[model samples]
Target: MKAMSPELASWLRGRTDDSVTVKRLHGDVSGRLFWRVFTGNGTHVLMDSGKIPVWPWIDIHELLRANGFRVPAIREIDTRRGWVLQEDLGSRRLLDVDDGQYMKLLDEASDIIVAMQRRLDGRTCADSIAGRRSFTPAFFMAELENTLETLFFRLLGVPMNELLELQREMRTLCESIDPSSVFVHRDFHSSNLMVVDGRLVMVDWQDARFGPPAYDIVSLVRDSYRDPGHVWEDRARKFTLAKGNMNMFQIARTACQRSLKATGTFSFHYRKTGDTRYLGYIPRTLRYLADYARICPQLDGLVRKTYRTLDKYHGEIDLRDFRSANIPEVRSR
Candidate 1:
């Protein structure tokens, strides 16, 4: 365990009389640092966000809790300093569960999402959150552009003309989705879900915003961390349709959009932080995107073109060798 920073130590001293111990926790791709703090009373996690304010997290936490979702409790907060003391939800993530348990948990997760959506449906209080954040066509296209810049252009050295063509297609596809108002946890994958006392708890709520109802459910089933299999995907689809009254096309389209952005995010992380672990997930994410493309007629040409381009540069662009390359760093938020 590394020594606690003076600022954190001082903060702990002010709050507790017992001896305090702090240990650094494994960090996420967001680059935010977390420390597990122990005291005579109990254990807590402190998030150090550097320049980012903690108010959005605090606000979202309150919002989710009020809507009957399981989110971590905020024990203390220092808004100006970008630090938050929150309850320890344990280290067992949904990704750590077994096959049978995984399917069961996902079913429960689907139920929770349906209940939450129903609770917020047509409610005036939802208007406040919807006003602040949303998944507009512009936002969706920007994410696709991010992937094009990082993965296609920078990493693979794709031709500018081709990149532009794909960008246009992506923009069109993004614009096709109906801009329905619903709560969406932008990154509701297995890694962001913690299993505490047999209940699935959502974390990283800062990115929650208004988007299509199928967005979060697609993210949950077609996750990058674990392959939930075709059987599970079918089960999930049936459950979602029954619970939320959504159709297959709506879910598949959102999945395609989300998977493309996720692939770009993985490439961006590897390029920026010199971390190759993220590259391993790109192939699976691309497969998910391709699956959706096969089902959606509008995405056929773009997917075929992109796959052909990838095959053309197959031997040349090795993800393993990328770490040794002299690529310029481009940081993304």
Candidate 2:
């Protein structure tokens, strides 16, 4: 832990009384840091993005709040400062609940997804920055390039030169998912959903953009952080019924790509922080990427190619035994 910079402290002083105190909180993979601020009046969370631009957060917060989403209430914001002070929404995340409550909260999150699609589905979507951006095939490949770099080439022994066919297949995987179908909460998952005031409040929505209708669903039910058990298929099916056009195949395809992208993210975080916690998540997502083969038989070639390359390079990562595979506590640079 490091001391707050003089610049950030000074910025906060003006917004608080002398009784205010600050403590660091667990952060996400992004370099952004969060602080729990306690004042004589109440408690709040202060987000410090280090040097990254914070307007996207501010803008997206306003957009979601205006559209009836239960995001944290913004108390103060300074994009140049790269910090935002907002309602704390407490520490209990959607994952930190009992099984029954978990399903209830998850249902609320799913409803939010449907509402998001209905309300944000219009030409007016382009007016906001979220709607203006989209998940294109190239964008999807760019995300997988991280996976190829980290999980395949760097971690596994796959040669960089050996990636041409896999990359082509990955591009095909990207092409199967529809782009700009709906407004997506780019990283919607249990960790990002805070349980506040008895409702599921969506956080970390700065990356909201136009993507496949199944993207957010995939991020939620197929979350890498927690296994939602047997209810997974039922949730996806219900979401499909609510959306009308989205189907199981679409969900399965997006899950394959999203899970792979998440694998790369977990690997990237482990490599950057020397954290072993991220390693446990990899096998699950790899299993998820493999399990979709039944629903997406069209991707059979891609799946076989991926497994062949992995088995050729890394023998320990057998998808069949992924659940029981033991990841060593190796420190990464």
Q: Which pairs of residues clash in candidate 2, taking residues 3 or more apart in a chain or in different chains?
A: none
User: What TM-score would every model get versus the actual structure?
Assistant: 0.90, 0.93
Against the true structure, candidate 1 has what lDDT?
0.76
Residue by residue across 114-214, what tens digits does model 2's lDDT show? 99988887575666789788889889989999988877776665776778788888888998786647888898899999887788888988888988889
Q: Give the Cα lDDT of each candidate.
A: 0.76, 0.81
Worst 10 residues of 2 by lDDT: 315-324
The lDDT of model 2 is 0.81
lDDT of 1 by residue, 260-316 (tens): 899899888877877767777777777676667766777787777777666554322
User: lDDT (0-100) at residue 302 of candidate 2?
Assistant: 78
